[model samples]
Target: QTDQPVTFLLKDRAPATLSIAFGASILWLLIGLSSGIVSALRRATWIDKFSQGTALAGASLQIYFVGLVLQFILVDKLGWLSSPGYVSPNDYPMEWAQGMILPWITLGFLLSAIYARLTRAGMIEVMSEDYIRTARAKGLSTRRVNFKHVLRAAITPIITVFGLDLGALLGGAVITEYVFNIPGLGKLATEAVSNVDLPVIVGTVMVAAVFIVIANIVVDLVYMVLDPKVRLA
Candidate 1:
């Protein structure tokens, strides 16, 4: 006997994936939503152009490439960050943040491209709708019109995408795990492929699938709450 349980391998590694995914998701969403909203609000301006340009770059870049560039700039050259590896938050909270920052940015910057475009498009479309004009005519404050009427309606699609992205991230992020040398499910799965470990592969896939399905269900539930039409029907 190897004196090591398969369950132990899984249990020990899951936190890395969870932590990185969650941290990255938050970082991306905040950047995406704000940039997107600003771009939509300031169309034809430098800010809009910059936002679109960055989005294009982000989407086009490969995760591994981004990860390596970030590691080199932040860790190797600048010495602004520590080495790439998982650090337990409980043991060293500051180091944990420092180690995770690069991985988080690698994924966040990539995914933010999709969100930025989607949110910008959604906001622009919502702003032009008849009801939005009506809200303005009704003497609603610009802030209220933009936030209450425009944003609330435009944010639905963003929510759906957010759920999907978070679910997918939680599942694996294979390149990310490997790049960061974080022993998450994704790394395990890839290692299993090299070793021809069938059971581990299957187990990881099942777990990932379950996470995706649950995330979708949560999205649907959120829809019911956000859209009165959904609740009515």
Candidate 2:
């Protein structure tokens, strides 16, 4: 709506969207991978059951609902966090992180639920392989066996999915930015649509597509580095 050109608008808003996506990516990967790995190693245990339960809940909940509930409990009720708003990290690193925590949690959680299930299935399958058994039989420490061997194998698909998810997030997290009152690309697109700013809307879509394509390329490179066989295959 501002008099600035679409390019300027995109450039201004790009950082916020990217930072949000990057933050969420870290949270989802960590939560999802850790939970999945642990659940797999401790199959049929209470930990596994709890993880599964949480994953189910996370997946089922809508993003808007999650954001509102978090705001109510964490911001409105507890009076712990400030209300969600975008603040540049360059201006105030600490405040930036604090501001982002809610959006990160909101965006991070739902995807983590899916990743948790995917990783769990992958881990279970990898753990049953002869190589896994052999690694354990070799008297390798649990940490080494799990991280060095098991995780490396089980994490491949997670990486692929993460690439696509990250790409989409980078494009714009509409509901999240809206709920959090952050003026990221998603919000820009939203406003553009409301204002019927065709240029901005098209610009955001193109930018998002670029991110997705780049993410896929990065994933393929990761695969090649992780497994030379992938390059050949």
Candidate 3:
């Protein structure tokens, strides 16, 4: 048992998966937020409706369902990704990305949609505030008012929520990882649960918990930066 590759595999899985997950999340977040900015600026139109509706649908989807659908389309019909296992880059970087892409979208889309909704909501609220109206009435260009005044303030709340959400997703990615068979920290966690591997499970949980705590701290710092009212003690 001590010499088993399983132990080492379990140990290494968390960091590798976390790195990829964070990267994917960040990419999707940037795309989604940029889209959200466009959506907010065009509120009460078809674009807004479509954007919000898409976000709603993405949020409502189950990770497993998304994974299965992608697997069916990509693996069964399209013949893109191999099933439920890692492939070496030297042999199959294409297949590896194909395999991971679905899970990334499954995880990233869910969070992205939530981010869009939050951003749009925040932007709308901020646009309605007295300072925003004053900015506009001061003969500032629409772009200046929206971007300089509204967006700067509006994005702060979104940042705070995003930090917390990312932390939660980092810890809770187990089911998504398992459904996609990604060999990530979440998969390790699931396996540990089945085998009652106390050390592995404890270690994984501690790592995830620490990540969440650090994320919250970072969010607090961001809050202070965004709003002068939030002074650090």
- lDDT, candidate 2, 1-233, per-residue tens: 56789899999999999989998999998999888888998999999999999999999999999999999999999999988887889989988888988998888898899899998999899888999899899899989988888888888998899999999999999999888889999999989999998888899999999999999999999998787689789
Q: After superposition, how far is residue 40 of candidate 3 from its true place, in Å?
A: 2.0
**Maximum-lDDT candidate:** 2
TM-score of each: 0.95, 0.94, 0.84
Question: All candidates' lDDT scores?
Answer: 0.88, 0.91, 0.75
lDDT of 1 by residue, 1-233 (tens): 22346677677878899989999999999989888999999999999999999999998999999999989999999998898778788998888888888898888899999899998999999999999999899999999998887888988999999998889878888989988898898998888788887777777888789889999999989989888998899
Candidate 2 lDDT (Cα, whole model)? 0.91
Q: RMSD for all candidates, in order, please.
A: 1.5, 1.6, 2.9
For residues 1-233, write the lDDT of model 3, one tens digit per residue.
Answer: 13455557655675547645675678668857876887998888999999989988888988788778878988789986666554554577776665566666667777788888877888888989998888888899998888777877888877877787778667757777677666777777777788887777777788779878988999888878777778744
Q: What's the C-alpha lDDT at position 184 in model 2?
A: 96
RMSD of 2: 1.6
| Higher-ranked by lDDT: 2 or 3 | 2
Superposing every Cα of model 1 onto the true structure, what RMSD results?
Answer: 1.5
lDDT ranking of the models: 2, 1, 3
